[model samples]
Target chain A: MSDTRTSAGVDNFAVSKKMFTWQVEGERSITILTAGNLATTQSLISLLDERSVSGEERDPSILHQPTMFQVARLVGATLREIIIGASETGQTSADQFGASIIVGGQIKGGKPTVFLVYPEGNFIEITEDTPYFQIGETKYGKPIIVRAYDPKMDFADAIKLLLVSFDSTVKSNLSVGLPFDLQIYETDSFTSDRSKRIQADDPIYQAIATGWGDALRDAFQKLPSYKV
Target chain B: MSDTRTSAGVDNFAVSKKMFTWQVEGERSITILTAGNLATTQSLISLLDERSVSGEERDPSILHQPTMFQVARLVGATLREIIIGASETGQTSADQFGASIIVGGQIKGGKPTVFLVYPEGNFIEITEDTPYFQIGETKYGKPIIVRAYDPKMDFADAIKLLLVSFDSTVKSNLSVGLPFDLQIYETDSFTSDRSKRIQADDPIYQAIATGWGDALRDAFQKLPSYKV
Candidate 1:
């Protein structure tokens, strides 16, 4: 990210990536990537089913159906090939391989799942306790998640929270400018149900951004200052 | 610097070498560690004069006075020697150079100053525009400064802001634990008039922290949620 870029302008230094997965049936699985690299993205998918990496000890009582490492390996290999091909064609680069995938969805008998895929091909799943995943300049929007996030929140609430989160991040960090690409998948749906690329001037997002900032300033002013 | 060490515990690390100088009059200086180095318990003094590092061209209209490179070199050399010696004695390590020296006060005709000395020995001054310096886990406390910091703020106000800043960081990051060493230096005062180690149980600090968190949560709740 160039230091010269101001917070006001929309500048894309490198691509930012994230993936999400949903499970429809006990046997069926689907993965979505912000940028296509199935091999690297698959590591995230496998993380969901892998119990050992979840920091959870082996306990039959917990009823863990581990994510298949074989699936992860397959995904990783595919992503490596895709990245290599993109590099050769000058469409992507080894250094510019920037993307974070949020993978979550139901798989067969198991409940719905979600995971965060890092650039280096490793992944961490979001348990029921920590239900959201954010990549790139996450601080400005974190307060919203910290306050509003609850495991029982429905998909609609999640989408609202995500938009607010992205809005705050975009305001604070120039590297994370938009047009933002958003994809929403319902549980049990193999296909992407809704997707949109939100531009900088999108009306709804602009409203949220302005409103959040003004609200923050007002709230701050209202807080009691130190009395010395 | 270890995560296992609590705020209440005494630091296991000890300084094995020391070098410092105190400015008394017109460039009057005395080297404290010209012979044998003092133990970690001995606090050293260092001066930052206009002859220090070269100043960046801010606005062409604004008068600039650069800090002396010699002062920076001396401070850096002393810190490096002490830190290395401590590490060799198994008290700390290259990575564990966590102490930060606040090297700022007036020198003759110059304004009072404040700086955060990095482990690498480099330093950045806190000017009127940027009025505070923090060495560790600065994120949580940043909002307070962003909202409250002003160049003309009184020293009392500055101290209050610093306490709030430190409070936020301590709450968020365990690595930046407290029993904080706070020193307040007034303008034109060559030596620190008030210096105190604030413990975890300090009542005033506790009240501010608890009050700030509660205020934040209250403000967040009052914000308008998504319309849809």
Candidate 2:
């Protein structure tokens, strides 16, 4: 889950789109969640789009990558190139072009993979020890995920976990806010079973936020009281 | 609460102090929690100590400040001055002098207040709308506080709340480790009733962390799972 809210110096909705996907029917499927400067991320995405659309042979587009690792490499390289170009053109410092992305999915017969691409053009793939990865303002919502993660967790439970995570982040930080873009791609499936935007007033979102808050309070009360 | 663990490319135990307190019998009491850089914070604290001990009478030391507001101002100014000096001496850039602090306590005949002092020598006080303040890796621990805070909460409950908050933070970030310094000052008492360091194997810390994790898993199970 990723929120649509974006802000600059003052509160303004300059950009909202932060989720993307590309699929080749039954051959491949991919999903990406992005965070950081809008212009830099958008440019990176646009570059990928332009490259894939050219349909030229030997293009380093994500669509043409043979494995998920290569896809991560292509994305990381494109992001770094955009940032370096921005710096060279006096757009901003390389550090000022800060952005991070979480890309996950399966491509054809390859096992599913998720990778977090960093600003330095280096990347790390999620492993069994760290089965899930988060980008952007990840800390606020991370505690619950760390405590409750299960390797065999079902899609429904995963969405609940993510919603609770996103909701906590939205409440604590202004940079990330409501109406998240959500997608779920089942293993071996070339398409997501669900892909939609969760609006502020969405019933499930409301329920999860309220339910989680109440449940936390209840759990807190159950803990042994501090010795006076 | 703050952890004692430290890291610089790798984890080690070079610094552990993260909390401090000062008191004037039957007059005022204050506690501070610091985060960011060790050098800047230690220098800032040392400056305050030197000024207070010099007895120059004109020194704007935090110990001599009549009100908590003035105390905050003095601390902020001291921190800013140290940062500026560090920059001027080619130690690092102004931004590289990054640090932040949380100061909270009550003065004689005054209601308790908490202030978050910024690196820029400016500060903001805690309000009824935001009753608590946190410094250093606050996001991982913030959701619990946001949900659990209450003006009328008892001292024991409040301590429980902070422990839970701190535990969550310690579990998620290696940079914020344990052997946390804890202190509690009740209203009208110029001295704390409880103050101690919680070691790595401290039963209370371990119990809270384990019990809270179990409670969260239980809570997750109770939430109506999303339909596939």
Candidate 3:
């Protein structure tokens, strides 16, 4: 899942897509979530897409990577190329070109997995012990996930957990907001379930957001009051 | 209230005091909370103390600042002086000497108030609309405060609220932990109640910490599950 809000400054936020998906029927599926400088991330996504569809190219494309590891490296290398290219023109410092990405999905021979790719062109794969990666405005939302995550939980439960996490972040931060883009890819499915763009007025989201506040207040009151 | 855990790096954290108070019976009471570069903050505190007790100095000290606003400015100016001095000595960049402070208290003629002092020698007073300021590791703890804060809440309820906020932060962050320094100064009283340093194994602290987790999980579970 990814939030659609992006901003150049605190006061000027616009809805912008930050998730990209690629699927080859019965073969592989890939989903990418991005956070950081809008221009840099957009450029990275465009380049990845162009390379995948471009014919007669010597450069390896994300679609052709043999493993998820290679796909993550490709994304990182592409990020570095974009940063170095911008730096060479002296348009901005390489540091200003930073972006973070979470890439995940099934790729034929590989089981479903996710990788957190850094701006420095390195990545770490998700593990059972740490099965999730969050890229932006993460702190407010993290406590719930850390406390509630279960590897055995169903996707519906996972989505509820995420909505609660997202609700917390959305309420606390101005930079993250609705509508959120969500997709679910079961292992070996090679294609996602009907992806969702949950808008601001979505009933379920409103329920979760408003319901959570009341529920939390009730829980807080139930806790023993602090004694002097 | 302020946490005692301080860290030079993620792997090396030590218990250190970050709250300072000055109380003069039936006259004035002040509390200062510090967050950021430990060495710089320590130096800032020492300098403020020295200037206050120097006896023959012309410069106004924290103890002598006539108003809470002036105290905030003094703290900001001292921080700027420390950063500039460090820069001039070629010890480190001015940016590395950054620190943030929250100063609050009641003076002889003024109503009780709080101010957030920035590293750049500027500050803003808290108002009814935004009655609290948090300096470091603030995000995880902020949502609770934003949700539950009530100016009319009694001192005990306020402390309970703060403990809940602190509990959320300590659970989420490695660099913030018990024991916490707490002081309560009632308006027009000009004297604080007995302060407490809540240690990790303190019974009340333990009960709240463990109890909050259980309460949160129960609250989360009770929220309506997401519908497909």
Candidate 4:
């Protein structure tokens, strides 16, 4: 989300870039959606990019990793390293450099998966019990997903559900905004199956946001009112 | 809200008490709904209570305030003082002392009003533009209120709206639990018009929670799906 709104002391509008995708196509692919501390995230991504193209022998880039777990570890380690460097002076940078990433995709023989990597270099994968992972400004949009999530739901439905989630977040938090970068990966296909950056005026996103709000009002009215 | 669920290291369950009411009958009245840290708020409330009943000079309780603005200032000052005191002692009570309060009611010959007091000792009163205030675990339930709130809404409808808001919050956050404390003050009557604690087994609350979920799922299904 873009930070189109802000209060007095806090601003997240500087960030419009929170999603990144890397793939070797037909082999393995990863998509990283980030939140928090732009400088730290940028540094982390640049370092990974440099290592990927540098052909350096001493260090292994995320692309060279064998599995999703390895990719998580590499990203986690790099994040910790960047944070440590940023915070070397004191707690200021440590606080300022905190970042989180959602690393998702599939490696060659593995099923498609998603993970939430924390600032501390530790991470957890989304399980069958919890099919989706969201980080940063997540609460406002959570209830819809909580009520509506289904493992068997089709990708189109999944996209609609997420748009509602993101729409809810965007409505409530000034820090999150459109256009949102969305990517889809098909199981066994080691590449981004589809992707789009939904702009603020995008027809589909507008429909979803307005439609969801209307639906909520309609739903609220339909509920049996508490007899006071 | 209560904490029935928690992740690895976060807990907001310390608060089962979030509603406080003060009324002098036909003269004046106020109800303060709090969210955020426990100790600081407890201290703030205790200070107000202490001053209210004390027979001392150099003290002005929240009741002594001439206007709701003054009342907001008093509460905000108390909150800021508590936070500063806690922070100064280096983690003794500071880390757990952050708090926020919503002060609302009517004063004799004055219009009914609401103010959201921040931890920083500042507050913004509710205006025609936004008729309600919510603090702590507020996001999950906000969209509903945003859609349903109306300045001209009857008190009965207002209560139902809030229940839905609280219901959404309770569903998404285990920290916000059942048996919620509620107080309603009629505009001219001053003193609390009505109050109730919706218990875990409260049939009405249960129905609302379950019905809301059902309504939401129904609403989601009704929305036009994306044509992928």
Model 3 alpha-carbon drift over 4 Å, by segment: A90-92, B90-92
Tens digits of per-residue lDDT, candidate 3, A73-189, equal 999999988877777888767888788999998889889999999888899999878889999789999877877778988787888899988888888899999999998887888
CA lDDT scores, all candidates in order: 0.49, 0.83, 0.85, 0.77
Give the Å shift of residue A99 in candidate 2: 1.7
lDDT of 1 by residue, A1-228 (tens): 101112223542544434344443435455544433334344434444363245565412111334523333334444454455546767656655444544444545455565555555567767667766655455555555665566776565565566666665555445556666666655555445565666668776676566655655554444445433
**B6-40: candidate 4 lDDT, tens digit per residue:** 22235433334667788786788888877676667
lDDT for each residue of candidate 1 in B178-221, tens digit (9 for 90 to 100): 56555554555555435565666877667666665665555444
Ranking by lDDT: 3, 2, 4, 1
DockQ order of candidates, top first:
2, 3, 4, 1
Calculate each model's fnat, 2 decimals. 0.09, 0.64, 0.58, 0.62
lDDT of 1: 0.49
Positional deviation of A173 in candidate 4, in angstroms?
A: 1.6
lDDT for residue A166 in candidate 4, whole number 0-100:
81
User: Where does candidate 4 chain A have its weakest 10-residue lDDT segment?
Assistant: A1-10
Candidate 4 residues A115-146, lDDT tens each?
Answer: 88999999999877986777777788888888
DockQ of each: 0.15, 0.71, 0.68, 0.64
**B6-91 per-residue lDDT for model 3 (tens digits):** 99889899899999987778888888899998988999889888887885558778778888888888989998888787778787
Clashing pairs in 3: none
